[model samples]
Target: MPEYGPQPVERQLPTEEARDLLDLVREMARREVRPTVDADEEAGRFPRDTFRQLSASGLLGLPYPSEYGGGDQPYEVYLQVLEELAHASLTVGLGTSVHTLSCHALAEFGSKEQRSARLPDMLGGGTLGAYCLSEPTSGSDAASLRTKARRDGDEWVIEGTKAWITHGGIADFYTVLARTGEAGPRGITAFLVPGDAPGLTFAAPERKMGMRGSPTAQVHFDGVRLPEHNRVGEEGQGFAIALSALASGRLGIAACAVGLAQAALDEALRYLHQRRQFGRPLADFQGLHFMVADMATQIEAGRSLLLTAARLRDSGRPFARQAAMAKLHCTDAAMRVTTDAVQLLGGYGYTTDFPLERHMREAKVLQIVEGTNQIQRLVIARDLLGPEEG
Candidate 1:
């Protein structure tokens, strides 16, 4: 398949800096990332080197504080950049999102001492991160995570497993949520665990259908020990911290889904223009043309919603509900647009000779990742009404 970016997005960036950032991102995506997709994804090879290059180029920490190696861009610009990257390769874009999510607790809630000591490396010192909140028994019920961390003098001994961790084995550090006091949300605490901790281990990466270039594995804490200083925020605050981080992470997923959908739409349009059907170009068919138009329209709509959510976040306003809605809408649009692209391309879309099938497969995971679409609706409904009743 010919791998190239979709048509450029007409972004409403706040500054010339943001526009330049997007330009650089598009260039990199076209030259560096697009060429590697087929081989790396097919071989299930994690693009560690590509990530290292992104880090060196300062693309990995756009939304954090510049004092600590970040680009210090607003969430609005950061998310747009994410869309560009994801349009090139979902593995790269989604991996960057997960990495940024892993940094949130410390960046937003850590002590000054912790920020001074850790944020620089976590943000841009070529370090990768993973967030550990969901256990095998608890996915959406993240507060019920079974991981336990017990105080032992100046250290904490942690045990239990975290499932579906992106960058699990290869990450440089992990932001972990564990039961520190009681049986529920209020008892959890967050900690920063080094990847090379004495007892930290990982199961084999999951055999996934798409985005296989990004490793998703089960991370086990087998009596892993962390310093007392590694704790993030106050005790009993991990659940809130996790939720806050996810609010932003949801937007990242939304942008990526929009990009994935756009890529599929772009390719489908190209094929329609070039390929003939019934002795006429597929683009000449009103039916296929309508499908293309709808796909493009939905992708644009999703992009607007996602950017609105990002702007709300940048304004320091309460945006959880908008974020959830964006995630739900964009991911669903991606699934629909990609499926439609497959239909638009007919037989070729079903084969590896084209990227529509891969986009379709990858789009499905966006609905499940960050938060499942079902959970997203619950979140939106709760915002519209009130908390779910027992």
Candidate 2:
């Protein structure tokens, strides 16, 4: 497959500094992430040291303020770094992306005092964070969540279970969304919950088909007390905050999907040139050449969609709908591209001997997480027609 996108109409080309940063990140991924990912996935081991290294390299807070010890780069630059990281190791890329979403809640909605006190530690990479929004009964319909938080004198007592929490048990802090008033999106509020807060506990991590290196669990909040100051924004603003964060998050996932698809294409192309059948290289076979062509075409189309959405974000435009389209298209492309890559490898693809099978497994989760593709389509359609259509 050709494995490159058509020229983007709205390009987010890196500046000189951003390009340097990407080069450094790419070098690190090649040196550190590439070699260890296979073993880490097999053992389901989270690479704490690698995360620490990434933090020290200023990657953890790439787009945040420099005052908080971040690199303060643009989203365009930040996402490309994420792409390279994902191409080398999906686990690290996912963890980084989730952590970034967690930070986005605080950065965008936090009071000055809240940002000053918490952003330093969180953005500095000393404390990893997670966002708690999904519930057992509510995944896509997040506003229908039942988790409640009632004001009690000087504190709010939070009570309920948050499902599918990435870094549930291991994160140093959590950005929790809970129902604080009536019975819909308008009643929900966001709060910053410390990891050691009383009455907070984690269910055992769910064993998954892929992305096992990123821990996920259900978090129970039973009368967890938070000082009034911990609230992220005005009451009833949680849904907006979450939606905004997710818009950006969708772009991150789109970038990751493109990176994965590209990796699969590159691997397949290399193998085709080397692996032989019937006294000739596989690439020489006209039948397989057509298959490669399809894979490349899909990957490029995915890239075109993803970059278009990302540029909308960089240009400060309302991009939620575009982001949904990008996430849906790119992730679906990744699933197809990786699956075909595995098939190209024939019997060896089914084994753990190569990364194609692992990539295929990893691609499935991208379709599920962030938002399911079904939800993404709904989001796009609602925006295209009108909010009343929702």
Candidate 3:
């Protein structure tokens, strides 16, 4: 095994108060989330009660302003809490992260009246949200979306379909992006559509290989009517808002990926110490020890990158490139770490008896969602080389 050096120092450490918050979050994860995760995943159960508990604990609105019943925690602290939740269950972790991203439109760009009317229910309790951006024809190329929103007097009638919405049918609200102008990305606009809107409907949840507990569906808006006040930001600004929201959402996914990797590493380490082979502990073998070392090193590096991007966000610095880099690196690291975890577990890792298989499955989706790793690379390259070349 390679001789490991001291772990790199964290540029910013959690304060005592932040540590206490993390403890509370970890306690919730261990007590309420961890035990139920496998069963829930197997049964395809959505943990509405878990989210309600999170809301009550003031976790649902972490990083938002306290005036709106949020914890007003920094993004760095908020991401750590998300990491803890994800270490327990990727379903809940990803769902919460998506919900937070859905709220960004209203919180950052909605009119005062819109915020007053909508944010309390979303940020407080009893309401979950979904962000609607991707369409069947356009996943990576959001500029090519075909969903239409037409203005008529005081109402905008939305007619389109959104694919892969995380909380499609179950959410209380949706932040929908629709085409409202000429063509391409500039035509897009966002609207806050109630789940119970008359013309809104959903397909059955997708049957996926992982994160089965969290619902994913196709949301159809067949002339869904919304008042003009529901529009979030200026019409052309929707794409910008969506991009901004996604930049942050990518960080959330990165944090969740790291958490998943950590969970896998912990499980493998525990099993390695206990599972004897060839008259010795599995951890004693040189080859396995080297693998374990690599997993730990990758996790620490992912954590460093995630926190760096989060701190940049909290400081109100330009961090789109950093966020993309973190998301790409962390999720890629997760895929590698989780795969090795299964390898370490031997036959048990391939079976549903252990959580490593599920972690591996969940890690795959993190690489694809909130902007694919390819897209992240593009974002980074654009940042470094300037958009004229892009």
Candidate 4:
């Protein structure tokens, strides 16, 4: 937004390779993502081609192991990559995150044979994925999900629906969480269902407020059959696997939030500088200057929290609390910053003439997805004051 190139995001990358990776990502964002994001999003066009390009460029599998087509990059580096992508186009950024989340069950808990057979295609074959955990009856209370999976001979017959599925109708694969045993979280089990599996159907994508470039829909499994080998983990381990995946998933949302906020801040600053008022630059107004400072400060703070949690995760430590906190703080900050950006632009912000309005809408969803801000606060509170007891 400033005349002097882009505002540099200060990062403590672990290696030269990581720095090079960021440079490459910036180039991709500038060339492939940013230029057409607004138009494509407006048209509700899924940027499948852009995702393919990212897969080809090795951007889709950054944090996973290279043995299975991943880049073997650290979580810190991977989160920064997400931030860069979100700064350009949130659809691409959040899509990449969902892809990563969908791969976790197979890559982390699947048998050696399963990973050997499935992880490669998922990580690098340009096949989009969706994680199916939320259902019509379940959102934050995923344990209460009613999706059912019954063992019928050599196959598991899955039935019920998954709501708020990213890439739902169009995903090549879905990591579905269904009830296989008792009730509650332990009864849940994860299944890898092929998109073309018989009895699998998708509702039309939701007409959402923002990030429309990514499809979100209701996925219905009507006795869809999959071989027993498709089960990702133990019969009663689905909820655990889901939680583990979410701990990491929350970090992705946090990074995307920071990126969105940064983009909003960038737009606001540029518009202020160019849109003059009362014979002076809008940016020169002391009140607006304070607002910009606050926005920038919030962005940096959120980034720091996310990276710290990422580093903890990369180092094999428990970073769930940090991830929750970061998700809570960053998404809230994005909502505030983007709304402020709209305010700074005055009436122009409300119009389609500027991207600020779209960004403001996009920022609202971040506060709800991955884990709602209320859920995040619950998590942080649980960390501070143990889980509630009966």
Which of the numbered candidates is closest to the native, going by highest lDDT? Answer: 4
Q: Model 4: which residue pairs collide? A: none
Per-prediction tally of clashes: 0, 0, 0, 0
Candidate 3, 44-122: lDDT as tens digits? 9999999999988888889787766677888999888888899899998998899999999988998878777778788
Q: By summed lDDT, which 10 consecutive residues of candidate 4 come out lowest?
A: 1-10
Tens digits of per-residue lDDT for model 2 on 12-85?
45678876777788899989999999999899988888888887888889878988677878777787788888
Q: If scored against the real structure, what TM-score would every candidate get?
A: 0.97, 0.95, 0.96, 0.98
Candidate 4 lDDT (Cα, whole model)? 0.93
Q: How close is candidate 3 to the true structure, as a TM-score?
A: 0.96
Model 3 ranges with Cα > 4 A deviation: 1-13, 388-390
Could you tell me the lDDT of residue 158 within candidate 3?
Answer: 96
Predicted candidate 4 versus true structure: per-residue lDDT over 1-390, tens digit per residue: 436313678877999999999999999999989999989999999999999999988888899999999999999999999999999999999999999999999989999899989888899998889999998889999999999999889989998999999999899999999998888888999999999999999999999989988899999988899999999989999999999999999999999999999999988878887888999988779999898889888999999999999999998999999999999999999999999999999999999999999999999999999989999999999999998999
User: lDDT scores for all predictions?
Assistant: 0.92, 0.88, 0.91, 0.93
Considering lDDT, where higher is better, how would the candidates rank from best to worst?
A: 4, 1, 3, 2
Candidate 3's error at 185, in angstroms?
Answer: 1.5
